[model samples]
Target: MKPQIACVLIFLSVGIALGECDELMKELGRSKTSLGGLANELVELRQIQRRVGRRIRSWEDKARQNEVYLGRLIEQRSISEGWLARFEEINRKLLAGEISSDDKEERIARNIVRIAEFQAKIDRRQATIDFRIGKIEKAQAQADLYRSRFEARESVVADIEEQRDAKKLLVLTLEADLEACKAGMA
Candidate 1:
């Protein structure tokens, strides 16, 4: 009678322990699945961030190019304006009869043509520079928006990592406690 009772007690104890182990195993599996999903999301987010960074770099390069072109246009405009001023001064002298040199008259006529050409070039370059500046400004704005999104994702990634670490610690603690409980029961 004593042997039978002890055998039944052992059987019941094993069944209860097996149930608990199954439950813990299920929970661990769930945690692992969640961690895997989170990892996949992190990978996708990182790829998107890389793309945004590339776009921002492209915009910056274009902006730099436009700035250099704008500088050149400004210099050209300054030169053209200076030439026009000199040509007007020469014309005034010629009209006032203060200069009677034929060479000066011919030089002033040539300068007028040159000034017209320079003015046209300056106008064309200014238009191009203006268009490029507008494009660069738009690109910069888009880049700023992407950068903000990247930062937000970065925060999310940090949060996920922290959660995963905490979850792993929890699993470890649960496993240790479960082992101790089993040993005590035995």
Candidate 2:
């Protein structure tokens, strides 16, 4: 009777152990699936970062081109200023009676026309430069917005990875506990 009772007790313990193992296996499977989903989300975040990087590069290129154009405009303005200064000196000499009145008048008229044309060209170029600068600013703002979004996504991914690691540790601990329980029954 004692042996029979022991056999019954061992059979019941084995059955309970198997049940626990099955449950643990199911939990491990669920955890693996969750990790896989998180991995996919991480992939998406990487793609977003790549796209934002490309946008930043394009914006930088445009800004470089705008800088080159601005430099050219500055050079042109500098040249125009020199011409205006020379014209002023010639007029001053004419007013002091150092040159003939007719010659001075003709020279002054030509200088005026040249100055006006230079001013018109400068104005047009400035308007274009202003437009380009505005575009560059807008693009920079847009790129910054994207960069912030990418940072946010990166933080989220980091958090998910942390959670997944913790979950993995928990699953391992649970597995160890289940194994211990089975060993005790055996």
- The prediction achieving the highest lDDT against the true structure is 1
TM of each candidate vs. truth: 0.48, 0.53
- Off-target runs (Cα >4 Å) in candidate 2 are 1-60, 96-102, 169-186
Q: State, as a TM-score between 0 and 1, how close model 1 is to the true structure.
A: 0.48
Worst 10 residues of 2 by lDDT: 80-89
* Segments of candidate 1 deviating more than 4 angstroms: 1-57, 97-100, 103-108, 158-186
